[model samples]
Target: MLVIELRLMQIIGLGTALMMPIIGNLSDQYGRKALLTLPMTLSIIPLAILACNRTTNYFYAYFAFKTLTDMVCQGSINCLALAYLADNISYRQRASAFGILAGVTSAAYVCGTLAARFLSTGLAFQVATFVSLFAVVYMRIFLEESIPADQGEGITQPILKEGEEDNIIQNDDNAPTKVPPFKKIPSLGYYLKARFHFNKNQFADLMLIGGIVATISQLFIMPLLVSPIGDGRLLSIGLFASCVYAILYSIAWSAWVPYAAAAVSTVMVFAPPSLRSIASRQAGPREQGKAQGCISGILSLANVMAPLIFSPLTSLFLSEGAPFHFPGFSIICIAITLMIAFIQSLMIGRAPSTSNAENSTEV
Candidate 1:
């Protein structure tokens, strides 16, 4: 069951990485609200279908359907939502909003898990689906398009010609102006090509590298931390400890998980914002989104790879029925990854001032 769960999660992670950028770009082209709604609405169908499948073959189908739904709805919606938030919130307030948002999400997760424990999985899932459908309806009714029609055209003006606009816009006054399909469905390939070809910015590279390193580190850390607890002697220790911890956690220490999670989230929430704030102060807001995107993309990639890479390693190295933390190999890897991340951050700081100077000049 554990192995199956791990594999399923890994597949979902990989699918998410592939889909997020596609959805994000789609949101940029269409409106975030509409694109987001489409996925949310579509996601329910799969969950509903899964609720009916009873056989082993049906289980595989369920996994595939659930994974697909998650890839489309979860990945895209999150990317669009974050971008949407960034669009409205001032830099000063963004971090606080993100922190609050993270807390809310964590709370929601805990509540959902508790609810699932009490309720049947099918009923819990169905309830979630209903809530999501309601959310989509709410968004459609209330949410305004963040990208103005005029601004959308203006942003693409350099790449799209006056003649092209005329052809795209027909004679009917009320006819929906035929925006270049590319403007509506931005392709990942095209966006990357344009970004790399036209924008020869070094900051993009920095963001990409930083993001990749961070992701790799996370991938290394998770397996090491989790797998050890699942091994022979380590497994026994972990099982006993977990029971004790669970009891304690249920009691006065119920807050500990949330507190610890908060601490970790606080760091993540602050890190990029702080970096951006310093960059904006010293260098300015030139190419901020692109740089951030590169970093985010790298992190997403890391999230996708972590489970895939770690699970197999854990299975291979750790003995069945062993305590969760036998050899301590995974922990060592995590420690090393942390050290590497620290070293990389220092190196990034010390790198030549050219990028900073350019950012300041652009600002």
Candidate 2:
């Protein structure tokens, strides 16, 4: 089962890696609102399929459609949204903007999980399908284009050569930033099941607690922190917390420990918006979509590598035929890897605010 999951993810990741850059770069040309329609509309098909039936034939049909749709839908929505925000918000204010956006998404996660806990499986899928349809409708009726369709003239959007791009990326001069792995991988749930014996109910509860904390932290705490310490330090703190979160999960002595780790997950939430803020400032005004797309593409490529590294390690450690008795070994390696990235992140000085630079130019 685990091997099957790993193979599925490997295929999904490769496809997503290829697709994200194309989606993002297109957003740069066609406008964020135009690109948004593709992912949102396609996402509903798979959900609607599952909402109708769940026999073995239906299940396989859903799986096939789900994989194909996710290849285009997975990272594209958030990537384009970030680019849209970049178009409207000043660089100095963007970290908070991104944080607020994340908070809203977290709130939705909490609500969906809470709703699903009581609903039957089929009903939950039905509700999800309706919600997805509503979201698409709302977007089409209410959302305005951040970039005009006519502005998508050139194919090339430069990322590597600009002076600002150098400032954005050069802080990791000694340590090139490899994509830090996260909850996107399937191994974490398998590790919990294999080790401490967590069930679906327990998983939902854990996620709810984590989602609540993350929503509060991103909505209230992050806005305040982003101004004082800046994106660099906040990212560093999130990375450290990420390491700790994995470490706690790795050595979880009791079931309660995972709950404690849930609280720690809030700090880890700070990293993505901070990274997005940093990445957004690197682009020229028209290039926001291209910059964010590049970031998503980089992450997709890392995700491609993640399961390959962890899945086999996980199988060996969790199985009775293991070379050693450490069931949590794969997670420990995950933590160690994060710790290395966190240390390297410390060397990253904050990219100077593009808005402030613009203001100075005006004066």
Candidate 3:
């Protein structure tokens, strides 16, 4: 059962890794509003299908549709939204903005998880279908495009800046050819094929290492002392907390140890968004979308590796005839990975700080 679920997760990750860059890049080329709305609209189909049927065939179909929609929706929305935020806000406010965004998402996740625990599966899916439809409708009717257009373009029209502000405009006859989307797929296919294999220990490593990427989208802590603390130091503190979390989970002797670890892990939420806020300052105005897309791509790659790594490890350790008496061996492996992340955070602290003038210009 664990293997089956892991296989499903593997497929979802593959889809995400393959499709995230395309959707994110397209959001940069086209507009955020459109790219964000389209995939969400598509998600309704799978939800509706799941709500209506519970047969084995329908279950498989739901998985297929869910994977496809997740590919389109997963990292794309967050990437584009960050790009949009970067475009509109000043550098000084970016950390707070990102923190608020992460906070809201974390709150929503908590609420949704609690709701899921109580709701029946079929009824939950039915409610989700309506919720998705509502999201699509709300986005279409209420969400406004933030991209700015030049003089002579309509106020509501999205700006399409090819290069930097005044590089060169080309005629149709002389313009450079665009690469077809198909050209990109072979590389993604190769990545998936090459990375599909993993051992139990490797799976455990992936799952532990993946916390970095997963936390980026929803990690948050209070921003009261951020200015005084600096992003680098704050990130290092969070990473240390995460290391503690990994250690606690690894040595957990009882079920309540997991819950206690969860309580402590809340401190780890500060790391990713601080990293993002710092990185956002490093990128130029025109390249925010591309940069965020690359980050999302890395996150997708992490997602791809996680299921392949963790599932087998989990199954092995939980089985009756395990190598040693340690039931939490997989988690100890994850702790080692977390220590690596903690070291990376310390390195981030060693890097030189950017000047205020440079930061002001970048925004």
Candidate 4:
């Protein structure tokens, strides 16, 4: 049973990793609002289907649709939102903006989990779906585009080129010819080349490495969802934990979950902003998108792999009848590693006027 579950998770992970980048790329071409709305709206269909599902085949179908929609919504819409925030905010204020976003998301997660526990799963899902749909509608109707239509076309050449007049705008005839649509949207070979040829700056490199390490660490911890004990043993542990959580949640006298969620959210909000701001200050505005994209991509990959990698580890630990020490320890190690990387990045900041020099270069 464990093996089969692990394999299923692996399949899900690979599918997500494969699909997320495509979604992100598509969002880059299309507007973010439409991409975001489609997924949120379509997500209801899968959840609604799952609510009525009674058979294993229906379960599989539900999982497939749900996972695919989540990959599209989360990968593309979420990534674009972050990039949009970065685009709009100055470097100095970005951390605060991210912090607020993180806090809201974290609070929502905690509240959502608690609500799911209290309400019927179907009802809870429906409410959540409606909320998301409403949010999509609100954003579509009211939210302004941060990136101008013209600005989002692609990277513009920096104003100040060496030995060239700063204000000069070359005629269309003098500009390089645009590639044909076929060449622009190349086959697999071209896609691979484009992906691989991304030029990363120091901060981008740090983000990519940090993202990979953070993801692998998180993945190592997630499989413990089944616990270190066998399914029979883990079931009791999960039930107990859920019961305790439910009781605490029901009391409603204190905001324990919300507070914890706020802390976690705050961390997430600040971490990226700090990383981006420091890196952008070092690397410049132009390369910020690539750094953000690469980081987002790495995190998405990690999200995909977490279940696959952790499920087996959890099974192995459970088979051995040992307490699940690895998950906590792995998370600690990852935190330390990220902290060190962040510190190292700060240390590297003392170098000569490197900020604006590389900002305008295309990644």
On TM-score, the candidate that comes out on top is 2
Each candidate's TM vs. the true structure?
Answer: 0.56, 0.86, 0.74, 0.55
Q: Model 3: what TM-score?
A: 0.74
Which consecutive 10 residues in model 3 have the weakest lDDT in total? 174-183
lDDT of 1 by residue, 27-95 (tens): 555666766676778777776665665578877777777877765555455446555655554443443
Candidate 4, residues 80-156, lDDT tens digits: the string is 56556655654434434543443344445445545665788678767776777677788889977543233321222
Spell out the clash pairs found in candidate 3: 203-309, 203-310
RMSD of 4: 17.8
For residue 126, what is the lDDT in candidate 3? 88
Stronger candidate by lDDT (2 vs 3): 2
At residue 217, candidate 2 shows an lDDT of: 86
Sort the candidates on TM-score, descending order: 2, 3, 1, 4
Kindly indicate the candidate among 1 and 3 with the higher TM-score: 3
lDDT of each: 0.41, 0.76, 0.57, 0.41
Clashes of each: 15, 0, 2, 3
Task: Please write out the lDDT profile of model 2 over residues 94-158, one tens digit for every residue.
Answer: 78998888887788888888878889999999999999999999999999988833333222111
Model 2 bad stretches (over 4 Å): 148-181, 184-186, 350-363
Write down the TM-score for model 4. 0.55
Best by lDDT: 2
Candidate 3 C-alpha lDDT tens digits along 148-248 = 32221111101122232222112111000001100011122122222343454443333232332233333334456455555555566767777676666
